[model samples]
Target: MLDARLKEQLRQHLDKISQPVELVATLDAGQKSRDLHALLQEIAELSERVTLRTDGDEARTPSFAIRRPGEETGVIFAGIPLGHEFTSLVLALLQVGGHPPRVSDAQAQRIRALDEDLHFETYYSLSCQNCPDVVQALNLMAVLNPRVRHVAIDGALFQEEVSAREVMSVPAVFLNGEPFDQGRMTLDQILARVDSASTARETERLNAMSAFDVLVVGGGPAGAAAAIYAARKGVRTGLAAERLGGQVLDTQGIENLISVSHTLGPKLAADLEAHVRQYDVDLMDLQRAVALVPAQDASGLHEVRFESGACLRSKSVILATGARWREMGVPGEREYRGHGVAYCPHCDGPLFKGKRVAVIGGGNSGVEAAIDLAGMAAQVTLVEFMNELRADAVLQEKLRALPNVQVIRHAQTTRVEGDGSRVTGLTYKDRDTDAVHTLSLDGIFVQIGLVPNTEWLQGGAVELSGRGEIVTNAHGMTTVPGVFAAGDVTTVPYKQIVIAMGEGARAALGAFDHLIRR
Candidate 1:
């Protein structure tokens, strides 16, 4: 089932198995089952320590389990683990076959300490770039803790289960048969949700840290650049962020980055983190800053507080909290977020295959989404609040060539329509005629724009614009002395990745200058 290049790569990866591994499949006479069996057979042939069997009794057909020789339970795949999840399958094999994981010793110990019996099931689509992180994280937890069991299910393959569960989004996770979360999450985020004591422990650890020369408050491209530049100055630097990748993790394609021909968002985020790690910066992930307290004097240290009640102090701070996807504020939008309303087209598009959907925007993102969805969705309706589309001419031309797309301009989305479990349609009003209309659809993709992550800074020490963005000077220094801001959170004109990096470097240098001349 795998090609020559893939087979060679699989062989090399499987060679790391230090213990015997068994693949047990519960399959039927279907073509998918046959293909899965062939794939397993080929995988088994790659290493002497790997073997395949057909004795699995899982309730789902075409499902398989990767386990040790004598173990009764391990990581399971309810469908073909190809595409984005292929790496998840490989990691499951290596972890189950006595290969050590790359997690920290503390993290491994915490996973082992989870004594309760927990079962997790994650629903994913093959085209989703964000599902692998969640799948691999749960698999690693299962391998580390025997009581933790996880299964990655393909939502496209089992439509019945998806319909029954009302799963309208990719990377939907369930714990103990109840909905847990329905978006991209890191391993630390998952642990923080499951383990109640994790927050207290982390807060205590962070509170004990000493003051830093430079502390960055985000982990997107801007925050990463600031930390790297500050650490390279031979000063103590610390970076705390909700996640290392930030909003970039939700992006799909990124071709405008100068010097790099083409790359994915996750790959670029990883490279940024790796490059930052090459320095002496203290990196902390999954940390959400809730409040910023500026110093009263130049010699006093500024304090940044977290939602977990943890606080870290620094001589000079760089604010690069970045931004998040803006949501349509219509009724039923929040009630059916995962049930039908989605903000990411790349992550949740495949779930609406062969179904009618609507794209709520007219910019480049919306036009590009319409073009991409025309291939899988039965029909795509592009709704715009303006009189005309603002996408590039090339993208508009491409969108016009799609046969199944319908564009409606000067239409404002009023309300989302759902049948309690899933979306059935939507309501919009025509701007020019003030006429109301509704269209039947299975999903709604919102690609409007971004809102800065500066709600915590409101009514605080820093000066903010009317739109809530941080106000900064030419040197990237904010109204508060020794506190600088950059990227989408500030009064920046553009929100490109390259612009964010340059602003971060400028802010870092500004902080250094402030420290020396004080």
Candidate 2:
């Protein structure tokens, strides 16, 4: 359930709700936990218009139905609400209770414009911070358009359905029972899947051009910076990205971006895209580099092929393909992604404010996440697999300075412990004692390592790290002369945004330098 402070906050928010809302949970009384009943009972007491009723069969044992004030039709939640999904529960109630719609006019316009009968089934874990955003967007769309039906399924609760769909991640959406999206996505992106016209336009654009002076792959901070710099030099620059904003889109708090004191993921992503668009960058949107054929033409331009069947020839290619978080791959870890199991603390840490959380790894990134989480979380536990902390002396000192943080070295994470809905705790083993220990908490932050996105370079001579990261020299030149690299995808030690941007600038200059020399 919620702490008193949070309970009060919910109560306050509920006070403003003008309509009645009912959450009918289909659960067996004998199998239900006492804490759950108590929690719902307390929530029911907070507002006169809010009520929780248990009237379900065996099959629907944890399903939730959100009934509006007077509407006969209600949205369904085929999962329990806990962990990061607690926010989703509150959001569902607020939306169904006829609280003034929080959607923007453009969002409403897009919802209204939906021509197809879209049924969005979002498979989510309780701890997934991104899942709620996707669910809330879909929920809003459902409220707007009768044709649009949105249902949130707990991947943990309905394992059979998840396995049937092969849902590997949270925030996974299925459009008309087909796999749609697998991760956190913008609203425009979700619409693009259902909108045929939008897809056709993208197809046309990709088929139109097949050549560029400088081609930048990946669209993270590094890729965006490279594209902008290359285009400013008045060269025919092109940018191909799976999505406009790279990993920065998943990151939440971004205070270290120099002048910007504070910013969120979505805002930074939009800004990066806008900045890139301001330049003459070709901006091949939503295209991914699948294959690279080196020394293709006599002109020395390499032929780069995309998954979308669009081929582009580039005299030089800057590989700015970023890195993805290294998952622990433990039981319940994959099931609880976006739920309690989180990789980017910057993106999902805020969702666990005042909640008990654990940070895996004792490296700089782990310590940094612990320090960051300590600012808001009630308790921060730092678990390091190694005997000693690998973070810098300064960061270790900073982490030790926080009274709310406790460091546990020589601890190997065993499994993430969670109820059917959300994470309640985690189990780890003491490397010295070989004894397992469980710590009750709300969230788990994994800051182990970053795996670079360089799998597509299978047939190329691009020198890469043993870990598959692209290896490059000071001039951002890869093993190949015309081919360059930068960002997290490269073997750069620091994966910070500022560092990536700087590397991007250097790579663009290096490409220009190569052109002048040639």
Candidate 3:
């Protein structure tokens, strides 16, 4: 039934197909004509392939099978693969073609032996540029191992899926149908979690009873400083963190920190960790602090339990848990984050150097980031929800002096717009004038504010301020004796690295005083 000319063209296209290459095409049941059938036969005669069969009569049933050319895998969809679903089909073919991107051999072995089928539902918005690395890393792993299957649902495209999963943010990944990890995770960490889950039968939960003299809860600049100061005081200090660096690791540079004129957050955290390690501090990486309770026997000692069920008793505690960036909480804001939007100027600014950028927020952090980025980026637009900037006069003067920095006060971000891959610009509405404007930029830095990391200590003995910061006396003494707090977690007027380090030293001294007196 096919025309001779069309059949010859199909034969030629099929003849050109080579080994180690797989072709996947999506065909609709209603659109399958005689010409298309002849083309399919030509493809079958030329190479091995798999065809996905969809019932033209029955709308619900869609099945896949290996056709004559079983080597080439063709994906036929009952529905269109347009929008977000197209990428999934391409990734599947890439996996079947033996072009599994980049998984280590050891990780691959562990992944292949995984007995249970894994369903990874990654809820993401194309707008979230920061999440692609996480998605790409997981997809690469899935490709390497057949047992792993990653299904990425565009949170914005599929409203039902988003509400079902309670997807609050982009880059949120779920493993084995359960919410496993949030934010972002590297490839190595993903592999570790998979291996842990796969070999979970052989592992037993470790019991608590391991104790230390001083326990540091976080591993950021403040936490690392506390560990170093405490260890130097000759106390058996222990430091625990889910990641080596706290939020600071996301920063690109630190110009305000005394002694360090310029330093990347990750590098600074690494060096500080090295210094802490040199002093005999017991460092536990990839551990989450779950709870803090008073020790049973000791009056001043407190027990710290980790998510891993490992616990440690400490005579004193320094709550150096830092802050996290507050999101705009707008629709599609999470999806576009990291793609064209970011939270850390120091970390992602350099990547957009000489390009246009928008800094959202009017406080010190926002003004500071705008000023800093103006030096690197071609043009910097500062959007503030408040009427005026809360930054100090000196910083205000400095920001005003920069010709490239444009401050738009009393403006709120409405939505972020991007090409489903990265950010192109953003939309803002003027609160006073009710005027809306869209500005084109390479990146948008959300410097709105920071939320203190003190939720874990709630109902504990430690006193917290109205703003949720832990309360400490001038000497870093908490309301509870023998318990001390420091860094951003405490009610410190200024949140600076040097100030936190000073407070850490003071807390360590105070702990020593308590121990000696006891």
Q: All predictions: root-mean-square deviation over Cα?
A: 1.1, 8.4, 12.3
For residues 184-240, could you state the per-residue lDDT of candidate 1 as single tens digits?
888888998899898898899999999999999999999999999899899899999
Off by over 4 Å in 3: 1-191, 197-209, 296-301, 330-332, 349-357, 367-380, 390-406, 414-429, 434-443
Per-model CA lDDT versus the true structure = 0.93, 0.80, 0.66
Tens digit of per-residue lDDT, candidate 2, span 76-136: 7776667666776787677778776766686577778887788778887665556767887
Better model by lDDT: candidate 2 vs candidate 3: 2
Question: Candidate 1: what lDDT?
Answer: 0.93
Superposition TM-score, candidate 2 onto the true structure: 0.66
Stretches of candidate 2 above 4 Å error? 1-114, 119-146, 149-182, 195-201, 329-332, 335-340, 346-357, 371-380, 391-406, 414-427, 435-443
Give per-residue CA lDDT, model 3, range 464-507, as digits (tens).
Answer: 99988888898788887777877777888887777877887787
Better of 1 and 3 by lDDT: 1
How many residue-pair clashes does candidate 3 contain?
Answer: 21
Error of 2 at 121 (Å): 8.1
Clashes of each: 0, 6, 21
